[model samples]
Target chain A: MIEFKDVNFSVDNKIILENIDLTITTNEFVAIIGPNGAGKSTLIKILLNLIPNYTGQVFIEGKLNSEWLKTERIGYLPQKEEYDTKFPATVMDIALMGIAANKGVFARFNKQDKLKAMETLDKVGIKQFNNAQIGSLSGGEWQRLMLARALLTGSRYLILDEPEASIDKSGVNSFFDLLSELHKQGKTIITISHDLHMLNKYCTFLVCLNKTLHCHTETEMLTADHIKNTFGEALKLIEKDY
Target chain B: MLSYAFLIHALLGALLSGISLAILSPFVTLKKIAYMGEALSHIAFAGIALALLLSLNLSLVTMLFVLAVAGLIGFVSRFFQTEETNVITIFLSVAMALGIILISAKKDYSFDLASYLFGNVLLINKTDIYSLIVLSVVNISFITLLFKELFYMTYNMTVAEVFGIRVKTVYYLFLFLLAINIVVAVKIAGVILVTAQLVLPASIAFQYVRKLKPAIIISILVALVASLIGFYISWQFNLPTGAVIVLVEFMLYLLSLIINKRSKVRN
Candidate 1:
């Protein structure tokens, strides 16, 4: 389980996130929805312990975030633009990095690690590209590669930020299908996304956020008012889709 | 030339420094910080000037001074969230001006600045060889032990940090090692051409291979071969060693580009 108590984050005295109280239980497919500049990414950053100066307490599995981090790891897939695609690494080389944090400083990745990485790649349906250069991958294939890396961490909790931003519609569907499969296998997935229709389909819980926690409830219980409160002017467009 | 002790020392120095810098070249290129080698070498000039002015051990004072400035560069960029290139560029000019001012302040300081500007590999001594050996070992061990961490951080620092890899620590350590490498390499390549040695081999390797491990191996080979040929030509013709080596590397770079183009056309 993960819990955030009275979380608030600010930069240069301007509030980015304020009074964000939320909880994500085990095996919950949670989707955080908000407009652009609505502090959605900042919330994820806080949960990942990437933002250290936030005013609040974050607990992962009953331990403080810092303490939990020392003993545990979280699977994270950042925005695609955050990493260099032209890096001179093969697909296998990148997938193997998922286990780097767990190994000692001088330890090498053994055959078992290679086998596991390949298996994860296979699971994500990109095993054929195992030896391919990362720069050769398509946008959707790159997203799958990142998903494989995240899965290789073997963490029960996965956090993804804008995983579908660059992929085609079909790619997004398959990606969410994979996420749904992972959720079925007892992984707690917390994702920041813009696709409300997909969220309504797969997410078990929804957290509406726009610089603050507008609402937190089951996906089935989400209302038009909740969407309106979070994305005021954009509500009509979102409602059109619904 | 082979019988002369000084010539042999120069060869040994080239062998060690060539391999060491080649090992670090791919990271520098992949991170897009190729200018860092040039920046740090200029920073070392200030260190050299200060040491000359204070009548101190040149190598020790210069190493300390460069390391401190490198650390400061890392700190300022991280703390202020400024573009690293901006910080590096600012420090490069500041250090260059300071070096010239300090050298001018010492009216009787007859330390040959030309030797440092263009390098004199023929003047390499046993002490230089030993320092190069130490540098080679330190660089090799650091990369080997932390290869995974470095690879991950270079590819994606945010993801590396998210996964609990100490990206900040690795980044700072990388800067310090780069500073040390620049200071040591200054003797062979000089401040003017050091960045070429640090960047060219990797650029050549990248043109031929897409995989990093092969690229690194190719980079090492390119550096070693260039150093040997450059050393020989400079010894026979009495040309400056650093300039010759950089020229050989540049020629190799052009060759790689042509070969890569041909292969693409053939495909």
Candidate 2:
């Protein structure tokens, strides 16, 4: 479970998020939707303790985000653009980093860790590329590899940022299907995405955010007025379809 | 040359520094911080001047000074939200100017500028060789203990931090290690050659191998072989050791490029 109370964030005195209060119960498939520059990513960053200077409070699993970070792990899939693609790491090397993150600094990856990594890679449908260099992966394959890394964390909560941004149509479908399966398996998933149709299909709840909390409700209860209010009048077409 | 104690010390110095720098080479190449290495080497010039002026242990004083400068670079870049390269460049110029000014301040210092700039192999002694050994151990242990963390940070620092890797601590430690490396390596390889070694070995390795571990091994081998052969050639021909080693590394890099290209064409 995650909770944010009166969370407000700013940079250079420009308000990015204001008066945002939200709660994400366990096993909920939450989708945060907004237009560009809507502080969706920033909100996630604050929850992850990446942006520590934000106002108000953020709690993860009944503990402060900072305390939670010290004691627990959260699976995170950042935007693809954030990766250094030319880094000379094999797929297996990157997958093992997940285990490395959970272990002590000096602990070596044993046989069990390797097997677990392989299992996670298989689960993501990229086991064949385990020994392949990361630089050789396609966009969709890279997304799958990143998914494998996130899964290998073995965290109850998975936070993904724009997982479908660079993948093809078929890739996005399979990706969402995997998320749906994870959600069904009782993982609390909070994802930032632009694919409203997919979010409507898979997400249990919708949080409309544009510098503030415009709407927070179950997916089926989301109305066109809520979309318009959050995304402004420019997204009227999307609202009409909503 | 083999009979001379100074010559043997120089060879030992080359071998130890080669191994140490090779261990760090891949990280430097992958992170694209060869320029940081370059800037730090030049920054060590001011450190050297300060050491001489204060009548302190040159290596220790220079290492401490360079570490502080590296820390300052990290702090200023983060605080001002400026590009790190911009900060490094600013510090590089200021440090170089300060080096020259400090060296000029001494009326009878008689500093051997050329020896510091290009490195004098004959000046290497037992203490220098011992320092190189310590450097080699530190470099080896650092890479071995924190290899995964370093790899994660280099791959994507933000993602690493998101996963609770303490990226900032590791990054600052890396900077400190790099500062020490520059200060130590400068005694044998000098500024220009140290920068070249930091860049060339991993570059040559990547041309042959695609994975990080093999690339690191190949990088180490290339550095060792270059250092040994460069030492022998310089000893045989009475040439400058640092310049000769850089040339040899450059030649090997070109050879790797050729081999890689040929393999690609055949495929």
Candidate RMSDs in order:
2.1, 2.2
Off by over 4 Å in 2: A236-242, B1-3, B78-81
Q: List the residue pairs that clash in candidate 2.
A: none
What are the per-residue Cα lDDT tens digits for candidate 2 across A66-154? 99888688888877546566677889988887777677686778899999999999988999999888878998888888778878888
Which segments of model 1 are wrong by more than 4 Å?
Answer: A236-242, B1-3, B75-84
Candidates' lDDT values, in order?
Answer: 0.87, 0.86
Model 2's DockQ? 0.65
Q: Which residue pairs show backbone clashes in model 1?
A: none
Relative to the unseen true structure, what is the C-alpha lDDT of residue B218 in candidate 2, on a scale of 0 to 100?
92
Model 1 lDDT at residue B190: 86
Two-chain DockQ for each candidate model: 0.68, 0.65
